[model samples]
Target: MRELLANRVKTLTPSATLAITAKAKELKANGIDVIGLGAGEPDFNTPKNILDAAAESMYQGHTKYTPAGGLPALKKAIIDKLARDNHLAYKPNEILVGIGAKHVLYTLFQVILNEGDEVIIPIPYWVSYPEQVKLAGGVPVYVESTSEQNFKITADQLRNAVTPKTKAVIINSPSNPSGMVYTREELIAIAEVAVEKDLLIVSDEIYEKLLYNGLEHFSVASISEEVKARTILINGVAKSHSMTGWRIGYAAGNAEIIESMTDLASHSTSNPTTTSQYATIEAYNGSQDSVEEMRAAFESRLETIYPKLNAIPGFKVIKPHGAFYLLPDVSEAAQKTGYTSVDEFVTALLTEANVAVVPGSGFGLPSTIRLSYATSLENLEEAVRRMDNFVRSKWQD
Candidate 1:
């Protein structure tokens, strides 16, 4: 076979979290008692008001393609959201709405990166980040952030990671695998580095509204106009309104970046689904009760399950402030259970214990595992119990 796949595609790594979640689903399909804690989306339905708005939009004939940059109305709603929620102001030209925050990110990378340009990605990143950077012909420079630092990169570390090729840095607060939120002071410090170094800040705020335990979401762009000028803030209704399937996410920042992204989107995706855009307008402009309700549910589940998961033999975890995931360092548990690696332990958990979680290697942390608590509390507790027992059964202690 003459070399078929493109080099960029060949270099890509599949999402480990999705791979394991699929395996769990496959096992369940075969009548195995598998409980998957690897899911990345909320278990709740999209709020009724948003659904109603979508239906109404179609009735009002909003089923056609919208402006590639997104409708002006939607942009206004997004601008309002920025001002109201994050104390940031943006005009329509500075916002680019695309299909989900994930695709919005892919578009941004494509427009910004040149061959061999480097993007500084923190350890414990979302599974898709480094891969997307590679697909854009950019190199990924990883900055390490250990569990001891709560899985957040320090400003000094970021400064050290920057090189002439370094074009941007990604900051995902309420981080995916770790669920850690950056403090306001931390953002200010990072923003200073980004401004000084003239590095673009790619801020992923998808989990912005899903914060917990009195923790407030802080947008790094809010630090100052200079910081905001160099930042492209990404957010969507997926995590906030349980609209994962709707595929509506937007980026706010420099007018030039937004225009390039919008132009690329016009040719690539045409536009985000019209119905979804209409729904999202309602999501931002409509009542925010359901948003808070879902946040509360996630918080409750975190409080209920954190202690149980931490109590598991040989598992060490830092309590997370936001997001619906727990990243527990299980290197000791993996070793004590006679497994050579966290990845191997994850497989055993699926086939032997009938519980599935994402191994942390995909997030650039090999000795840990990421478990999402987005499932029902009953399921969450039961999965932890199975993991606890599975470790004990193979314990060399």
Candidate 2:
């Protein structure tokens, strides 16, 4: 029976983010008091305006199918958003909506990739990027970044990784796991390289609006006309609007590329949920106080967690510039605890401290671990406290 499965699926691995969440749930169900720091979702409910819009859509019998690209009105909303918020102009026809940013990414791979096409993915990326590339019959060429560089790949590294078969590069600013937002200068440098090498850029800006301090998130499409012509700007309301369950994300790019993505979506899932499409229109066009509130909450949590984690004797934490995560290099913790690897250290932390964190090895950094602060301040405080105690008690040379 197992042999009957398709060969492609046999090689596929589940998303580490979802896997960790599922394992945490299983532990909780068995009466263990597990606190999951693995989910990449906001701990907030959908804004009231979004909820009202969804209800109105349902009332208007919008339960029927929408155009594959997206509802025309929703596409316009996305265009306006790009122009107003990100200083980039886009046509409605250039927008393609998907179930989420994940779906938009998967569909991009499906439409453009052929066997052996390579995509340059910077390390400490979102957990799904490489796997999606693999599933799309492309090879994921990972370029490693270290904590010293703020987990960003250098232009020299980008130049070295490109080959004739290279099709695209996934640039995720305000990145998941690492929470490092690439600066405008850094993006300009990468865009210059992409233009020289003629590589397509899939800029995942799902976490764009979650930036902290005075740090700004620059859209790759806004870098230059050359980049705008070659970049796919992927964003959504999930992280920004706390609408993860609503499942609405959109991409803007060259009309031809977006047309292909829309066609693939038309055949695959058709339009994303019609109700979600309606709610997302409100997300884009409505008042954004809710978005600001969520951003403020994440900033406050970062303030609380960053120092606490760094205070631990052996733990080294990089202050994430954006997103709701902290990537602490815990190699010293593993060495002191006599653990063979970061994975073992993670297992021991979960078992001893009842705190579930996604190990950095899963995101391509074997010496660190990733923890999402998209939870309550109470939970973050308690989880760090428990982890500190567990390290002090059990981790000795």
Candidate 3:
């Protein structure tokens, strides 16, 4: 037999979030009571108007392939959305709509990176960032963010991470796992560092609409012409309109980079599903009522669950301002409960306590765990209670 695995895949770690969620599903299928807090998507169904749009498109026979980049109408809708929401302007030639934000990001990396090039990633990042960078033959250089820093890398930290090989820096505001939304000032500082370093800025704003406590989302690309010139903004209707399955996400940036991504996507995904593109057109152009409704539901869940999660013995949690996850420092809890590490504690939660969460080791922060509030309030509360009881029952105090 010959060796077949590529170096790209041999080094890749499977998504920890999905792995935990799958284990919870398997347990649930066996008639166990499993509370899964590992999923990253919103629990709401795709909005009604978007669903109707998809059905109507099918009836209207809009099932044929769209342009490799996207349907022009859909691209126009996305352009209008960027202008309306972020005060950012982009031409059609500067946009590349791919299968989803993840795919769009993957394509962006493919087009932007060369072998041995480095991309600076902040700590506790979304799991796929580093993997996608490596898959595209780029090095992932990490910059740390402490809990005291609200899990956001400062301009100085970013400046310190840059090397001659540095090609880009990714900023995911309303960050996954951390749920930390960077303020306008924070983004400006990071953008300034990118401008200084002549680095590409990959701004992921998928959680833009899910911000809470009257906090508004800011686009790092809008910081300045200098910043926008270097930025490749990644976003989609997935998180905003509960359209995760729609497979529609777009990136906006330099025309040459966008064209290269489009060329690559044409050979890869062909076109994003035409029907889902129609749904996303509605997602951007239709009523935003459901978007807010879902955001409010998540907000309520976070408020209700944060205190309970913090109350768990030896758990130290900082309240998140946006997004739907709570990343709590549970190193003390793990130690107090006689677990050797957070990973062990996470496994015990799944097998013994019927709760499943992604350990922070997956996000490069081993002292913590991420709990999503995307489920129903009832489930969130019960999950918290189970975690509380699980810790107390094992408390070595």
Candidate 4:
């Protein structure tokens, strides 16, 4: 018999966005004019200063392996950033850098989760959270939220989802897909329940610096000392600095938990690229101008696109407080088009309108779709116009 892949590997589902992107590519290859809005990436270049740092490191021969946890100076820079930006003190030893925020999250799951342990994940979560937990032999308990509450679950929801097997709770604010930022009061209330349940907190703050409309991002760890001790704060320079390819992400938490995650990293994919570490150090410590410039651009795009998209017949768009994505509730459109679900609606949009948007089924919200406005303003306007025509022609039937 042919060799079989590991059962754990088989448990993973293919990324929904990648699937849609691949189909878009196939259509484009056949000379189709497809507007890809399904991506979760920032359409910006790595800043010049950070690129220069990476090049300098290469010339300086810093390509050798440093440590599994990461280079000392890079870790120190992370610690300094945590303190300076988030007002949270973290020792260098408490910080571990990995290939990306996703990498760091997977490593943490492998280190802490045992078989059958349950991870409390908010529904409409990032696509990888549940799959990562399952890969680590844990079960994911999803807590659903509705658009009425801006797609955020209440504290009571968390309390209801917990059980004796609960191990961790993930909090992603300025969240992917929905762009929902939890308020300080909301976070504190969630922390109270987590403390009572003795659950670990995985705070994904990758979009911390991408807030719009003057909304601030609060680190879950910064709420209280007890929460800080229990939280593994995950952040990276990807969304904020348009450094997605640099592949630098880190987490800081209780020294023991951090050490365990670092040890796990030691055995698997030891230290992330040395050059990437050096570049990330520059990103964390260098000028704040680039971040501000990008944030301003994103805010402007939001202002322009929100009303435009909302004006489309049968389309309902939520005003996101942060991040560059707008998740439109498209169930009405689905019903109008006789599509029955968002997945079918998105497929029809792609096939007929040449617009690629990710269906919400992957994020546990089956009646919505996510559109990334990270593209140029002209492209955003064109995308909505094309989608509007498609809805009016097809949905009006």
- Which residue pairs of candidate 3 clash? none
Model 1: lDDT of residue 209 = 92
**Residue 135 of candidate 2: its Cα lDDT?**
87
**TM-score, one value per model:** 0.99, 0.98, 0.99, 0.98
Per-structure clash totals for the candidates: 0, 0, 0, 0
State in Å the error of residue 190, model 2: 0.6
**lDDT, model 4, position 390:** 80
Report the lDDT tens digits of candidate 3 across residue range 240-335: 999888878999999999999999999998999999999999989999999899999999888888888899999999999888999999999999
Question: Which should have the higher TM-score, number 3 or number 4?
Answer: 3
> Where is model 3 poorest over a 10-residue stretch in terms of lDDT?
300-309
Error of 3 at 259 (Å): 0.2
**Residue-by-residue lDDT tens digits, candidate 1, 1-397:** 8998777788788999989989999999999999999999999999999999999999999888789989899999999999999999999899999999999999999999999999999998999999999999999999999878999999999999999999999999989989999999998999999988999999999999988878888999998888999999999999999999999999999999999999999899898999999999999999999999999999999999999999999999999988889999999999999989999999999999999999999999999999999999999989999999998889997
lDDT of 2 by residue, 1-397 (tens): 4678777778776777788889899999999999999999999999999999999989989999989989999999998989998999888888998999899999999888999999999998888888889889999999999888999999889999999999998899888888899988888899999999999999999999999988877898897898999998899999999999988898899899899999889899978999999999999999999999999999999997899999875799989888898999998988887888989988888887899999887898989888999999999999999989888886676
Q: For residues 34-153, could you state the per-residue lDDT of candidate 4 as single tens digits?
A: 999987778989899999999999999998998999899999999998889999998888899999999999999999999999999998898999999999999999998988989898
The global C-alpha lDDT for each of the candidates, from Candidate 1 onward, is 0.94, 0.90, 0.93, 0.90
lDDT of prediction 1:
0.94
Q: What does the lDDT read for residue 15 in candidate 4?
A: 89
Which residue pairs clash in candidate 2?
Answer: none
